[model samples]
Target chain A: MNKLPDALPVEKAAISDLARQTLHGTVDEATNARGRERMISAARAGASKSNGTQRRRRITRASVLLFAAAALAVSLVIWWPRAPLTFVTTGGEVTSTHDGGVRVATRDAESVTRFSDGSVVTFGVQSAGRLEGVRTNGARVVLTSGELHLDITHRKDTAWSIEAGPYVVRVTGTAFDVAWSPSEGAFVVAMRQGSVVVEGPLTPAGVSLRAGQHLVVARDGVMRMGEGTPPTLAELAVASSDAVALVSSAAPVVVSRAPSAPAEAPPSSSVPAIATSVAPSDRPASFAKLVAEGRYAQVVTAARGRGLEWVAESASLEELVALADAARYEKDGTLARAALEAERKRFATTQAGRNATFLLGRLAEDSDGNTARAIVLYDEYLQTGGPFSAEALGRKMLAVRKTRGDAGAEPIARAYLEKYPKGVYAAAARSIVGTP
Target chain B: MPLTVAARKVVPVVRWQTPAELVQALLAAEPEAHGVLWDRYSTSLRAVLRRSLGPDTEVEDALQEVFIRFFRALPTLREPAALGSFLFGIAVHVARGLLRKRRIRRWFRLTDDGEIPEPPDDVDPVSEQAQAAVRRLYVILDDLDDESRLVFVLRHIEGLEITELAACLKMSPATVKRRLARVTPLVFARARNDADLASFMAAPDQGERS
Candidate 1:
């Protein structure tokens, strides 16, 4: 009854080969043995319902031992210690590492501790803190005295926090500066990019600080919270010796504290900014190469230096696409839009150019918050029959819902569900349609 | 010199030649038939599960579930000669259930430790490029619906024939073809668009049907 040809067409065969090579692999003998044992035990247990008590007893005996083994394995996995942070001190002395805790005291120069996830902590001269714990996702730091600068990398499920005296600053991936004096009971936190929550005395409920915000509590229980100016590139260069290049991409922020203003310096001097349009460039010949090397910040800086519009006009199609990617990564929406528009203008008929409309739609919805414009772009992209059609439709539906309410989005949701019943947004569409 | 019948001694060995015979033996509670069934199809089923699940550590558990389910449903299997297809149907069902569970877990912000599949040491290590392609492919698949994802993997990765795919997915051959036609080009286009997988996938123009 198999009437179709055995040989897949050349293209299909090639894809078939690629997928096969990419995915298929051998299951090890040990896993196979374990599976076989489990299968037999489970099957026997099921069969023992009809069989005599002897088989039931045998199954029970085997199951108990299996349960014990599984328990031990799970315990071992749970209690395993994550790898510690590898660090380097620049011309300073640090305490000997014990277990997972290390006291860091910078005497003559600053010390930098780097996490595996690309987060960096730089302790300024005369600063002291102990590494309370380090997990795969984050670390717990206790700042006893002096200043501590954190350029924590943002990642999914990151959990890093800083404790000073009675105050604790919870961080979910952001660059910030914090200073604490145990004797004086003074604490300061300055946010550069992402948001953070600070919990401490007086206001025990915790205060949330966004980018460019600052918080300070004095030794005498006086607190002053206000807007802070981000520091200039020149100030950051003078503040930390070698970290200038690392943090140059950030625009510095400064906040003032009343009681500790004279005794302690503002934490803004060490704040690491996320995306300063101005940064040092490696002068790569192509933006794609820079992106491949993971230097997104530099790509934006170089693109901006060349004039975003100029780069969009003169750069190669590939380079323009790469520039857009870099700008997107750097959270520079204007540059990203410019680059994408350039692709649509120059290589209008090319595959990359056609895909640009979808990316532009995403940018419009996410960064620009132009939901109506986003829907238009999504419609345009969908009409092109591009590869991202499903995603575009999904985004357009959401944008419609945002603008015209759920009732307005229902038709689009129905169309989306019809076209892509198992698409990424299927569940959301189902909810919109009130389907189970 | 040839030995005469009087001087020759023979030992006899018995084996089940067909899946129907194997099924009958299994139904008769012959213990050895279970091993025979596993020995016949486990490797193929394991590879299918591996592709569908994407290097998850729960593959072994899923594999056991397939066998146990197959055993329980053996009597209900109308076409006992089509045992491989029945087993595959169960495997896909189990993989879909696991994917649904994973989605729910993600919604609840729970980490799936079972999702991290252990690297195989027995096989020669894959090149970094191939590994990247694998990751990119799976990420794209994750965006598709469960049925489309399974169909793509079963048809393309597992190299199942259209008939076999229809049997496994419990869809008509026409429906299978339609779904494949819709999804295959889109997936290939996306793969071609991706930087890492672009080199691995055939160029769109080169592979396009004239």
Candidate 2:
């Protein structure tokens, strides 16, 4: 036993004999024969292992290169550019073609379209259209038939244009409604913002419609301006849905640019001249004209029929409101309700929306004897700054008192009196609230 | 009672040949050359493997790997006459490679297929004690880095000179000396903590600071 320095006592040579014995298990002679056989076998195994490693390296390198190439190919497919036509599908089939023309057919269903430039177009039943010349800054389509509600997102750099039978309605951006009825030989464009300019082959002079305006033209190129100003919010109190929209004969929709009425409202915008394209035979008897001629039953009959719905869809706001009265007079509660509902749904934020809602309330109360419905509609109209807010509030309180009594209506009666001191229902409001 | 002499009397392999002729015969992969090299180097290679590794059954496999590598590389040898270093080079590489693998297995808390192999039953008491001390020293030395252990084993136990150890390990002489300096204190400290090896280490009390 000895103390080791800088190393252990387990010296290499000291353990040499033992290790060899332990590993070999024998120190016999004939060792030469044994060693030669083992060495030959081991050498063979080593050669195999080295070859296997080199083959594996080659395989791994090939696989990595293949994977990178595939990824790049997939990247190229996703980013390929300059699409001819972008397909949009709603509830119906979309046919995408190479000619930049996509026809949306809604035979029995509705088709909703999302334009590339951030606009949404919804086609009504039996409506179809072909969008052509699609561009980055605008959507251009030729609507064939039926109705389409459009909402163009606010892109000052873009515009939306739709060619219905005889007229093309063009707008920079706006929420609007359009309809084309060949049976009625009529085309109508209604919009609330982003001035629309209507002109077509039949219209040589294009008409620029400001917000709240509607331009109606017949295939005869006879254009009539329906004083059809839709209701702006401030005008709700005085503007009835039945208020007369100015009647003016507009230029026909034939020429490419049909000479336009001034782009701005000129003070004396000519004696509202009848643009020469107005052909009497090409226009159907309009709803307003039918009503003016006191054909109430005919108006209601047309409003309820499928053939005339396309015409009714293009009815001026005043004509639609008047149609409800005619339907009520004919005792067609369903027809009248449908007429008013259409106006309310289409112009829910406008003065016409308030007017239609208030009248529906009156019809429900008086004609249908549904006081509860009448009360609710009056409250809704009043809340929307109803043109007849003072009246609507008064009617609400009266309806409440008549049905539920003073216990539930004292506050509403007070609200009416407070808003309209000398209103038509002021006397009754005062009585309900116990004021002099 | 020397093992070599006793084994020689029992049996003999091919007669030894001149160094130059032996290298030529070895490169030619002659069975006789293989037998002679085996007879000459197996004992030293086993000792080197066992010291660098530990007393284990794997040492036999490592011994086989060294011989396999040596024969396979015989033709590549620029100076086959210098087979001593070439053979030792194979032994060093195989042994170190096994030690690294064992270190990794321990790091991942892996064990051999089953329980450890039991020592031989015929071992004498003194020889068993010596084997235990050697095993204990290695168990602790495993904690030292591989290069440090190489310097310690070659310099002290194997008795290789600094320059020779450098050449064997493929480092400069200065590097080997620097490694030796670093390993001395570390080997000392760990050896002190190992119950089986503490007795063989000098300055047991000062082991902690060494």
How do all models score by TM-score?
0.35, 0.42
lDDT, candidate 2, A1-436, per-residue tens:
2223345333233332232333332333465445546765665554566567668888989889899999888888766563533546667667874666667878788888886656888887877776666775666776666677788877656666777754667678887777776444456676666677775422212456666666554433334444344222122223322221222233222211111221121222332322324343322335445433334566665555533464236655555665665566566777777777877877676656567788789789878999999999987887775335655787788899998888678888777676455455778877877778
Stretch of 10 with least lDDT, candidate 2 chain B: B1-10
lDDT of 2 by residue, B1-210 (tens): 011211322226545455556678765556566556666667667667776776554465677788877766766888755677777778888877876877787777765434566765766586675577667666666778887877777665666777778888999887887787778667656766667655545333222221
RMSD of each: 28.1, 21.4
Residue B36, model 2: Cα distance from true site in angstroms:
2.4
Compare the candidates by TM-score and give the number of the best one.
2
Model 2 captures what fraction of native contacts? 0.11
CA shift of A300, model 1, Å:
76
DockQ of each: 0.14, 0.07
lDDT of 1 by residue, B2-53 (tens): 0011111121215665878878988887766666666666666766777887
Q: After superposition, how far is residue A63 of candidate 1 from its true place, in Å?
A: 28
lDDT of 1 by residue, A25-92 (tens): 34556766666567666666656543445577778988999999999999988777756556544445
Candidate 1 runs further than 4 Å off = A1-12, A49-436, B1-14, B114-123, B203-210
Q: Candidate 2: where is the Cα deviation over 4 Å? A: A1-36, A44-436, B1-20, B192-195, B202-210
Q: What is the interface RMSD of each candidate, in Å?
A: 6.1, 9.4
